[model samples]
Target chain A: MGKINIIKKLSFTIVILLSSFLFIHIVNSQAELTSPTYKIVDPTVDSGGGRSESTSYSMLSSQGGALDDARLLSASYRIGSGFPNGIQANVPIFRCAESSTDSGSTNCINFPNANGAQGECGIPGCYDRFKVEINPSGNPIDTLYLVAIYNEDTNTQYFLQSDHTLDTTYDINDYMTICELEGKDTRTGSGCETGGDPNWDLSLQSSNVLNANANTNYTVKARALHGDFTESDWGSEAALTTESPTLVFDIDIGTTSAADTDGPYNISFGNLTAGVVNTPANQIWLDLGTNMQNGMTTYVKDLYTGLYNGTDTIPSQSEDLSVDAGSDGGFGLQIGSVAEDALGPLLEGTTYDLATNNIGTVTTSDTEIFSTDTLSTNVGPITNGRGGIILKALAVITTPGGVYTDTLTFTMIGNP
Target chain B: MNKFLFYTIFIFCTVFTFSNVNAQETGAVPTLFNTEPLEIPSEDNLDLIAPIVANEQINIESSIKLSPAVINLERGSSYLLKIENNTNVTKEFTIVKSAFEITSDRKLKKIDDVLEEKLVNELEESIIIEDELLVIEPYQFKNVSIEYKQPILNYLNGVIVKQRDLLENSDENQSKLDFSGQLASVIIDPTLTREQLDQLKNTITIEPEKSFFGIALNSKFKIKTNISNNSAKLLKISGDITLYDGETRIDSKSLTQNYPSYFYPNDEVSIEFDFNKDERSVFNQIGERSAVKTLKINGEVVQISDEIYVLPYKILVLLILLLSTLMITSFLGYRYYKSPKKSK
Candidate 1:
């Protein structure tokens, strides 16, 4: 009876040892299983001997073997998906590449091996391309990426799959391998075989994403499905910002003046002979520049209602002065023609066009004189922004002459 | 005898000619002076005819920038006005002070001549500038200190900083287009408090329209109400005249076309309303009825009420004539009855 108990105990010990070994092996295998790697691809770059707008995700075996049998069960991404927060939606990656095609194809394809050999994908840096489409509706161009699902049971990769085909119906037993590509080969003749492509870059558009406004920041992240439909942790967050808008404004003397030192601001209409129209030699020039979408406007007001010398005054006209010599005595301003600088095509106010020689009435109240509807070029060395203002005055025979003067204030506002 | 006469005539002619030449040379008898042709004043000769107005020849350039275009000056306080010379050459600016008032049309009416001598002197003394002349170097700036002393009243005044031509002579004929000086409005804060401002309302006087005594015979009648701003502060006056017949409002009309935007101190505006044919008829009816009529003139600060009697003098005259006729007839009849009966 003692011998029999010893035999049973030895057998129990062997069984325990074998069970422990099996459990440790399973745990080790799980610990070695790593999440897939993901990244955005720049269409402008010639990576993998091709250019395309796509997000690349790798799902290669640990042995660096082909992904012919190892397939992706599902793939998804989210914009402004910073770390710690879970990705809420899935974006499908379309299968644009056929067996005989290269990287130029519009669909997702696997990157070749270091030797530039085909059908030998799944090495490190050999990732499958997920196509991203740019949405042009918003101002900053929001982007939407497509998610793809590969059914390992059917041994088929689905192309152009919509959100409805996410394949969540599959059981967790449907396991798959996930891999990532880290580097691209950049060689002249050898092509992705000898060295990585130095020009290869990544952008938000390549990942099918964009900002809603100029000068705004955005974050992106991606998660991958692995064996048993287990989702790996999200990759490192990718942060970027959109470009900013610019606006510039300046004031200088119009080049039409005989003397540069005399003005850009002040205009003088010399002695007014009775029944004669007199215009200043120089005009006041206003320069403006902006990248604003809505454009800008300029307004002007006068300190005095008319040109006054002591009690004698030359009154401001109610309407645009006829400006005819020997007409009524009046004072006003005329907006000259538009002289475009680098970026131009500014417009004059409807009331004060110099073509008609109609010196528009300037009262104590503010009046619009010049405006523009879009981005304008900076005031260049060659007279730009727009033309200046020409002061016009006419004195009748009865106008008592002294030193007639008035001050005008110009104001400009921009809409960005 | 003919030879003797010829010689005598020749001698006399020669003597007269020599005597005239000698007289002209000796400055005793002057020959009718040969007059040079007069040159008519034309465009070419305008300069000779009259000294060209300096302003006409001047091409005024705005080279200087004056900041703080408007300021509120408190009594016993000082403010500095910055003047920037944008030119490379040295520039001189002259400060000119002028008294100004805002007109009803919102125009700046220079009242330099309208202000009393005492007020003008006070204004000149109250706002004292360190220097009326400012000389700034190339690309330099200068500040003019304006000190407001104890001011007697609030006034809207202007400080005109004119760019002086240092290169030109001061002669009036030396034409130089001077830079039309930039005007900085100096609004002197009133020395009076809110209570004082309210007290000024009592000084406003409104004269009622003249009472209509005679019958309303003309097609139209004039009702004039004179509103005077007797206070020291500027006021905006606007009101209406209401005609009442025994407390029953009959008619009302605006005293003036519009309220004077600025009713300056010591200024009077006449508010006249002309009664049309319909209005005259209403008054005539009132006169015939002998009803109590009142004219009330209302101003912004003052109101005046006066009784106007529009009596029907024509009807009264007719009634008197009728009574006299009846008396005369009765007297004649009595006399006829009392005296010797000469009845027929």
Candidate 2:
């Protein structure tokens, strides 16, 4: 029993030692990371409009403290994906003060606490969230990086200017920023950050400026400045793209390089039955693309020919021939939809779906077109950069046919 | 459990919260001044012609004239000299630059110590003197924009132009024309103030100010400049800023970056460059820290506006501790709320 008592006492001593060590560890750990821990949870910056002034964006720190102010250490816009350190160091670094309290006000961030729903620094009276500004690149910046460092002033920040942060060492419980050789004014925003926001991007309004155009795609990335020498991990990347890729859009008549002005868009549907429709001569290629995502469309109209006999004009009731753009790459033009574009006199009961009769298949609509900057456009029944339209003349069994012809206008209208 | 968790969170806020600071440096380095996004000029418009007229001494019977009968130029600047072709016919004129002989007479003009010199030698070493004959098209003039990349010996210079017509592409027979020895004298003058080029000075004005240069800390300074463009078209211009310590020239930075900026007419742009001495500092260190008495910017129109200040390290030490204590307490209270038993 006496031996048992000794063991018990030893166990108790070990427990006490462990507790003391853990308590010290918690305190020490806090101090080590106390040099303003932060993250640009979302570092993807998107410049809505291409301007020459400071473009703004904000990110509230998730768990760390407040960033009273941040100096723009460096910001550069480079082409391709790789970034060179200080490549654009010559560009002016604009100041972006923390906007933890009011969205509109530049003042108000001072504390470091996380509340239930609101971030201690992300919301009110805290430095967890920072409002950053990008200085003038002057040129249109579509794909680039913006590095900003958070400035910490222990005196102005936490009222510890008396604490010589750089030259002196403090206990784990202290709350002073240890900048270079100064007291409370610790400068932590001087490091070079190479790993950027993978999704960093910028899209310009016009191609004339900085080679940015409606078809261009840009990426943007950023990171938060940490300790007097540390930098937080890069945040998420922002993308700047409005149009679908030029490769996704495809159109082919008989040839891929034909244009609307070419005479290759002609289709002739032989005699049609009262209840049976004849096949089309040829089908127009298509990939009716998505809106702005793909691009705009243009339909060029040359002329419309009314169906006529060698001598007499056909009656309006007998005009039953019609044609329009195909629905898919394989299908020809829809021969006789009720609303189909047409000009002729024939039986009222005859209609043709280009795919079924096979005179000419109606592929998808030509929504996939190119922007105006494209040089030497392709000429085809359907072209991504340039395009043309083809029409076929169809006739009913009772209708008179002397080779009635009508011109189909191919039009391309772009997205806003 | 709730009590422990709440206390833990509260402790987290107290021990692990708040601000981080950044670093910066400044000192005047030759800075490149860039223009804000202004209107882009038409393709037809070009930079200053140095002379307003295409030809100054054209014979009444001749169809060409060198714009400025007499020319004055600055060092390390790009100049656009025009060879005018006034005739309606599509004519091509070939200029022999080797034939550009310097006159024996030396004239004197003084604007600065660096700009005082003789005229004859300036002509012989003129950067604008090309090796081949320059061609000028009909009705449209051609300009030779020579950019002097090196420092030049200050002097006044003179050159008389001689030309021949290229008869290859034209059907007109080669006619004997004595277009030689016309006095198109150039005064390769760097003196821009008293002797004026009204075409540029009257159209563009640049006012520069050195806001401040730091002493002990990492070198830093702000160059605040206002460039006013009064002409009709946008200006695509690049300039350099330099630092000088009493007569010793320090360093220079080419404002060639962010090139071809559009400077619209009637626009005044405010440019502030907060520069720091890292590798780009123009001034050498006095004792690990660079000190300078005068800062010079030689780009655009040179007018110096200087501001200097030293940092105050004393007040930074004597902080109102009570005021700081009060503010810190208030902020800490707001950051760490009383965690209820239910918050776990």
Q: True interface contacts reproduced by each model, as a fraction?
A: 0.00, 0.00
Candidate 1 lDDT by residue in tens digits, A16-94: 6655664564443233223467332111111111111226832221111111112312232222111111222222121
TM-score of chain A of each: 0.44, 0.28
Write one digit per residue (lDDT tens) for candidate 2, span B173-228: 21110111111324333343323223232211112222224433323555444455
DockQ of 1: 0.00
Interface RMSD of 2: 30.0
Task: Report the Cα lDDT for residue B248, model 2.
Answer: 44
lDDT of 2 by residue, A150-233 (tens): 122222111111111111122222221111111111112322111132221111000101211222233322332323322223
TM-score (0 to 1) of chain B for each candidate: 0.36, 0.26
Q: Relative to the true structure, how large is the alpha-carbon lDDT of every model?
A: 0.41, 0.28
Candidate 1 chain A lDDT trough over 10 residues, lowest sum? A117-126
| lDDT of candidate 1 over B70-145, digit per residue (tens) | 3334567876777666565776778766554443422333343336355767667756778898888866777888
